[model samples]
Target: MKEAQKIFSRPRSLRNISTHYCGGCGHGIAHRLVAEIVDELGIRERVIAVAPVGCAVIAYDYWDFDCSEAAHGRALAVATGIKRVRPQNIVFTYQGDGDLAAIGTSETIHAANRGENVTVIFINNAIYGMTGGQMAPTTLLGQRTATTPAGRQIGVHGAPLKISEMLALLPAVKYIERVSLHSPQEVLKAKSAIKRAFQSQIDNLGFSMVEVLSACPTYWDMPPKKALDWIRDVMSKEFPLGRIK
Candidate 1:
């Protein structure tokens, strides 16, 4: 019998350990994508990640590279400062919807507007996963969340924020893509988008962001497989997936 070749292995940029995110959570996949990009670019040693308050706040524990914990909604600002001082290094911010689209809106917009040489990995799972499944800024309209037991009413909760489009309007932003991980094909596309976002910064092109439509199974109260289906069938309707810029 012929020996089978190993098809895959964990990227060296990721620590050889399990993550804390709940089963079916997309943060783990996002982390692996970032690690794979860092490894592929051979910049693991020079990569600095800014992890903000959210589900990924403990990302430093998973990634092998240096990481700084930033306050909620301050990831972009912190990454901006880090990239400015360490121009030789690659700086990226890993932020969730609540942290990025809500509290960090100003920081994120200004950073992209300023054309900061940084990469932003925005995970838009719609509802905030870490803090009791609250309705986040990106939470879809008419979608039920912990805070919106009756489903999100536009009149009361307002329309869902389209952050990627808003950021693409900034002149300094060189790249903006919205991808999802609801299926194998989408995951591949998401990985490609992430690589391009990192490459843009490496080339000093300007601010780049790849908004990933991730799944929050626990909060969504669905199994891992069902959550993915929801992302494809329902969630994607509100936040369409594509390259915004």
Candidate 2:
């Protein structure tokens, strides 16, 4: 007789095709992780994901969960509405630095401060990706993007926005952490954090967030290795991976 299939299995949430993201883009990894969690939690039938404009704008295509396309910078508002009406469904918003920290800062902040019971997967790659390399709210000091061609200087452009830290200060935020996918170890930590964030909501914990310091090799004008090195040596110092509060 054939051997029984292993208990472990892959998620059906992912599409069976090569993604359109650039090589080494972290969104694909994050999407896979989220999808895995959805399947593991057996919420694939009831999970609803909200996608915003940015590299993650088309996340719906890759994830098999029910998804809604929100206007640029309006994902949180849409997510809040869905969760309010359908409290039984698990709601998550996948957003990039440009969408979450820049254009949608108000929406994100209000959602967290209001103690909204939703999961936020905020990807901070430092620069804009989908709209070409441009400065984002998380863009580091002295980093060049389309808007900051000569590198970001605080005297002119202002300091980078540490959104996770800022949200951690809000009393309504129950759990907040930052993790990276730079290595296998870090990937495990991120997976744990993502799981906790979801479990927290399942317990009605409120406003949990995992700020993932991702890499943007294409926008940084560097190869995948150097982009990762930059994330380790440069970005980590400014953003610092781990629980902020």
Candidate 3:
């Protein structure tokens, strides 16, 4: 019998502990990808992640590196300060749709506009996962949520905000890519995009962000498999993937 090769293992930058994300939630996968990228780049010691106040509020618990908890919707601001004070550190912010596109809109825009030397990991699950299933700024039009039980209406709720596209228009932004976690191939692409985002910051290139179209099965009220399917079939249509800038 041939010995089994160790094909996969946990990333050194990731702590050996279970995450609090709900089943089918994409946060875990995103966390692992970040950890893997940090390890690959050999920057775990110098990396500093700013955790958001949404579903990933306790992200510090998973990453085996320096992390800071920011006020709700202030992750970018916090990351900006850290990166400025410690110019040599690899700084990044992990934020959700509500935190990034809604309450933190100003911070997001200003940071990118200023060309802050920091990476941003924006998780767009379409709805507010941490605080009930409210309609997030990235929530697809006509999508049902706790606040929009009858489905989101254009005239009343307005159209979904294309934040990534808006950010790409800024001259200071060096890179911006929208990726999804619905399929294996896309996951690989997401990892690549994330790595590039980090690399851009490392090279002292202006602001870089990778918008990940993650899934929220519990909030979506769908099975894990169905939730992933929705991200591919339904969500991707609204927020198409690729290098936006």
Candidate 4:
């Protein structure tokens, strides 16, 4: 029998740790994608990952690159400080919907407005994951969650927050795109978009964002497969995964 060639299938700059996210949670996929990108781009040593509160807050624990923890909803601020002080280092903020589109709205907007040379991986899972399933700003109308048990009512909850569209209008933004991780193909696209965001920053292009429409099966109270269906058939209608503006 011929000896098989040794194949390196894992990332060189990655750490092994049991993730805290529940089964079918999209954080793992996105995290792996980010790690793969960092390794492939050979920037792990010079990259700074800013982890924010929410489900991905402990992300620093799994990444081998230099990482810093940001207060709840202040990832953009932390990333800005790091990128500005050390422009040579690639800075990226990993944030969830609750942290990015809600409480950190001002920080996000201002960072883009200032053309901050940093990458932001904004994960939009619709409902808040860490602190139970609250209706997040990106929560789709008529979607049922813990807080909006009777389904989100447009009259009371108002319209869903269209963040990417809002941000694209700003002149400071260099690259803006939205992608989903609901399937294998889309996940690849998401990784590509994310890689582009980091590359944009590396090229001194300011304010690049790749918003990922991720799934939260536990919070959605659905099976893993059904959760994906919801994202594909229902959520996509509202959020429309693509490069907006």
Candidate 5:
């Protein structure tokens, strides 16, 4: 019999369990990318992630590393405290658009301004995935949601909040990039951006963030494939991909 080579297997840093993400949700892909980067950087032992109170609220259940739960919109605050106390550990926060931009805006901006040595993986799915598809701070103008049945209006809802660009204005911010999970090519780019963010923290560059334009099929009321397409066609226009800072 011919010897078989193992071409694929789960990353050591990722837990082997079923995820609770909705079908076609980009959280799963984002989670895998983080785990892969952690394993590749050999920082699994020292990685401490602060999970947010959004769609990825139970993110600690997926990643096989030290994790702490934070109150709604408090992931960055918790991560800041953890990093300040234990500068030796690799600290990061996994948050969603609702958690980071809506309620946690203050913490996000202040953390970047202070140049805190922490990595932030921000998933911008536009809608609040964990909260019955409510409109999020990043939700596109004219997009419909549970709270915006008549479609988001410029006068009523205002424009979508470009939080990534806002944070890039801070001098203390080391790196800021926006990536998407609409296609395989974009997914690879997202991984690269995430890795760079993590590496920035490792190099003590301070305040690295990667804003990933992810998909929420259930909220969007679209099929899995259509959700990905919508990201590439519609979402990317508002939040273009590339390094901002």
Candidate 6:
């Protein structure tokens, strides 16, 4: 008999086409994890993803399922509508720091507050990767960005928003977890958190979200490996990992 396959190939829920994400960017990993969960749960056919306006706005091109585009910071609103009308569908929204935490904070908070039965895959890369490395709500203190050339200052930029923790206080939010992709161990943990988030939806639980601390190497002006190290050494301090609920 042929030797057992060492490892499985890419999930069928993900297309074979190349992505436009930068080298070492965590969006690809996030996409693969979501696709893997969808495939494993046999929900690829029922999955409906809301692709918001950001770095992942074109995510529909990579995922092999029904996907719709939402205006800037409006992904949660659109997803709420879709899930409300098609309660049977597995609805999820993929959003980045700028799109979700900055412009879409109100929608996200309200959705969780209402306990919407949908999953949200939040990519928190600290800086806005798509829009010229500008400062985002999640950008760490002292973090440099195109908009914060002198480094983030509390007097002007205010404090970085701990969105996961803020959302965890909502009564309707059934589950909330913050994870990172800095190392292999962290990646595994992140995947596990993502799986649980999806399972929460499958069980018809209230709002569930998995905030992934992703890296933006190209925008951060560092090599991919160094960017991962920064996430582990510096970024995690501002946004600690683990379940909020």
What is the Å distance of residue 87 in model 6 from its true position?
0.6
* Pairs in clash, predicted candidate 1: none
Clash count list over all predictions: 0, 0, 0, 0, 0, 0
> Local error of candidate 5 at 94, Å?
0.3
What's each prediction's TM-score?
0.98, 0.95, 0.98, 0.97, 0.98, 0.98
For all candidates in order, the CA lDDT equals 0.93, 0.89, 0.95, 0.91, 0.93, 0.93
* Candidate 6: worst-modelled 10 consecutive residues by lDDT: 2-11
- On the 0 to 100 scale, the lDDT of residue 178 in model 2 is 95
Give the range where candidate 2 is weakest over 10 consecutive residues by summed lDDT.
Answer: 8-17
Model 1 Cα lDDT, one tens digit per residue, 1-245: 99999888999999999999999999999999899989999999899999989999999999999999999999999998898888999999999999999999999889889999999999999998888999998888888899999999889999999999998888899999999999989999999999999999989999999999999999988999999999999989888899999
Give the better candidate number (4 or 5) by lDDT. 5
Q: Where in model 4 is the C-alpha error above 4 Å?
A: 5-8
lDDT of 4 by residue, 101-141 (tens): 99999999999999999999999999999999999999998
State the displacement of the C-alpha of residue 233, model 4, in Å, after optimal TM-score superposition.
0.8
User: Residue pairs in steric clash, candidate 6?
Assistant: none
Q: Write the per-residue lDDT of candidate 5 for residues 98-188, one digit (tens) a residue.
A: 9999999999899989999999999999999887999888889989999999999989988999998998898999999999999999999
lDDT of 1 at 144: 86
Candidate 2 lDDT (Cα, whole model)? 0.89
- How well does model 4 score by local distance difference test? 0.91
lDDT by residue for model 6 (1-245), tens: 99897597899999999999998999999999999999889998899999988899899999999999999999999999999999999999999989989999999999989999999999999988887899999888898899998899999999999999999988999999999999989988999999999899989998999999999998788999999999999999999898899
For 1-245, candidate 3 gives per-residue lDDT tens digits of 99999888999999999999998899999999999999999998899999999999999999999999999899999999998999999999999999999999999999999999999999999999999999998889889999999999999999999999999999999999999999999999999999999999899988999999999999899999999999999999999999999
Clashing pairs in 5: none
Error of 6 at 195 (Å): 0.8
Q: In lDDT terms, how accurate is model 6?
A: 0.93
